[model samples]
Target: MNIPKQRIKISLAMVMPALVSLSILMTMSIMFYIQYKNEKRSLYNNTMSLNLSSAQKMAVTIEALFSGMRQSLRASANNPAIEASAASDQKELQVIFDLMLQSSPYFNSVFWADQAGTIRVVSPVGNNLNQDRLKTEGTTEALQERKSYISAPYRTPAGRWIVLASEPIFDSSGKYHGMIGGTIYLEENNILHRIFGSGAGNGKESYSYIVDSGGRLLYHLDKSRVGENVSSNVVVKRLMGGESGMQRVMNTHGDDYLAGYASVTMNGWGIVMQTSVSSILADVDRNLEEQLRSMLFPIVLMLVIAAYTAARIAAPFTRLYKLTKSVAAGQTVSSEEFRPHWNREADQLNHIMRAAAESLAKQTLSLQQEAVTDPLTGLSNRRELERCLDSWEALRDPYAVLMLDIDHFKSVNDTYGHQTGDQVLKLVAAVMSDDVPKGAVCSRFGGEEFVILLRKHSMDEAYRLAERIRNAILISKTPYLLPLTVSIGVSLYPEHGRSREDVFQAADMALYRAKNEGRNRTIAGVKSA
Candidate 1:
């Protein structure tokens, strides 16, 4: 069969460029992976910080609301009509209670109850007026104990949530006669939003709510949850115990949230500021997409360069092969066989091939470097961690994996904005990179989470490393942002589990436990025998 030179040239052009492009494409994929890791971390931090800050601000507003209610109750207790508690004083007491209800937007009702448990007067008179309060703890405590206090939130007969604040009434002889009380109808009260300055967030997924010491919701954007028990929730439990802080928690409804909580001093009630994890990170994800698009042009240009260079190198080889094949079949060949001449084409091919080889080599090196690298933090990414896991599992090399999550990182973005949040993440990344033992692999596993592989380290050594990182994070301060802290979960390979995935899961669970137990600490995974 006769072979046409044009056909050979055409095949060479198509095949060589394609082969070269394929290799370049594989390298480009790694670059894209690196880009993805960096973008995701930035986005995650921004979202988390935003949610955190929103929660904290909402917490402060809630404390102030409770404080104002307490102050109002105190002022009302000193009224002459309330202190007198006489039958003739009912008219004046009604006027005072009515004025109190009008002035306090949150007040649902106000009433004066005698020591005998008979309600003398009530403003905006309801079924409860003239009712006995012997069964009510709030009224009994104030009337008998001669003290001022706030009560746990409860649902009234009408199914509305209300909290009572009561102060003991005393006669001129300082004898406890009865009590003057005020009620706050949580769901109907617009006063909370007024004081908190609107409990809504940047999106529908963000919201705030109030819970008493028992974890029964007093107020919520979703009214259905009101009067429901949330005591099983980790954050709620902590807040009910009078602890105030922020963390990422998964609620009983199976929703993950960045929550900030604080306890109200007067009643031990909790203010919860929370937002969905997905909604908080949405803007960051969009930003990452735009970044990828911006990088597309450069990638296209590289592919073009690879193709053109491949074609030049392939042309001369195609011509040489054809000539050799013809000669082997007893055809004569001369030095000046082609229009361009063999020598001239040989020189041109050599130069083009060298240039193409150099370009390809440089790109290959770049890809290798970036394949496991997180660009923004200059650390290994999840891809690198996966690679190390595969190698360690195959070689049966013992190691420890530490999963570290930044505590309350979302609040940073909420308070200082995303730009400052980025700075906080970078600082944390730096700390992790610097603090780990030499030869350990430190990586950002996306967002405020990071992974570190400690080679041949004992469980004790791993714990120390984790503790150091945790402590460093706690002490680290970023401008315009709060101090940072990290929770670390440690799992040893072959000890925790035989497989990489098993070890990773074990570590993750331990990390979850650490966060659940209150953050800014380290916990070791349970290893199977």
Candidate 2:
């Protein structure tokens, strides 16, 4: 049983609006996806920038604290009473330590170590002085240097993680007498707390910390992780190398974060601040979701309008389709002089059908011309040349094909503007097009290059044609201020080879030879015959 063609046409018309709407929706979705990706990238960059700024600020603050502590120690070192008492009675040295500790909130405790590396005095009169409690290696090294030393964060014998700040004391003879030092427990310090507190206030779901020269956590908002060694972390190693930058990392808690680090002014310490990736993209996610919802509303509205317009347009086509179907079914249905609906699209479609039937032959000819012409140069394109070559090969015509290339074309494009480069190409194309013989065909192959096919031409004739084109291009003044030259290579067909591929390959080889022999010259390929 054959279904009526009219019904098929009507069914197609009904579905056309749906297809159009789907295509539009897909296009919009792709565009929206690209926009969302760009927005997410921008957000990630912003998060990195913010983290860097915060890290720098925190580093400055910590450096200032260290500076203040150094200044205080230097002032205490110059006092004759403290220096003299440090070498004598241990109780008198303890009195000096107490004074220094009370003067600064930054110091947890102050102690005096003699030249023998013995902790003679400790401030605040705490536990009994244990000689083993002092780090002999660091104390002896600091006293030997006879200058202030800021030791990297370490675990004290008392089990407290602290940084040691020590300044050497000299006797009246300028001899190294002993060392006075203070302990700064990073855990009790407010630097990490302050940085993380501000970030939290800004609704950032992340934390900040300070790491020592060895990549050991000095101060961290996560108390449990303070003193944890992070030297093996790749990002920490990068930080130790004085590279302050941003990275995405998963912390011990298994949460992904966009972390940024900056080195402190002190030699080997740095601050790292991080924020969660999700928090950074939260705004973009919300905006995209809202945009998707809004896009759906417009798409639905357009689809409804398209459906109504399709129904109105299809009503007249429905009748016309029936008449055409009757004619096709071997029933001589008279051409109905039925008038279409008053809608403009319906009337225009009816006119289109009539025009299409009458102008089919002319349309085909126009399409053929369009296929042959190069849209940019208004010359024959490669497709047209290939078709001509096929026909010429079939006839076994003896001819020559030449390929030409502009020397230093990239230099021209870079030195001059692209507009000037385009003008140069067009000028070359026009010169070559006009210089070739009447029966020969010339085309712009692609950027700064052109090809020519010469009919019934010998190798000498082809070389002469190539030389004329090259000399014409060189002598001709282009719209660009710079002069131009071309390299041309010619190969004769039937003499070179019977096949099109062989002829083109020979021409390409000749072109290479021309380029190697210095540009602005023509080279012809040797023929077998």
lDDT of 1 by residue, 1-529 (tens): 9986664345666755564455456555766677667866665565556655665666666667667777777777766655564556667766777888899765678877777878877889764543654456555565666677777776655566767777777766887767777876677755664565464654347777778889998777776677789999999999878887777888778988777777777567777777777765675567667867997898678667656755676656566446544543545445454335355545554444344445555766698889989887888988888887778778889999999998887887787788887887788899988888788888999987889999899999999989988888778877664678888899998899988888999999999999999988899999876
Best by TM-score: 2
- Tell me how candidate 2 scores on lDDT: 0.75
Q: In the order shown, what is each candidate's alpha-carbon RMSD? A: 15.1, 10.3
- Each candidate's lDDT (Cα)? 0.74, 0.75
Stretches off by above 4 angstroms in model 2 are 1-24, 84-96, 127-133, 187-204, 249-255, 293-529
Query: What lDDT is reached at residue 77 by model 1?
Result: 70
lDDT of 1: 0.74
TM-score of each: 0.55, 0.58
Which candidate number would show the highest lDDT if scored against the true structure? 2
- Give the clashing pairs for model 2: none
Query: In candidate 1, how many Å is residue 480 off?
Result: 32
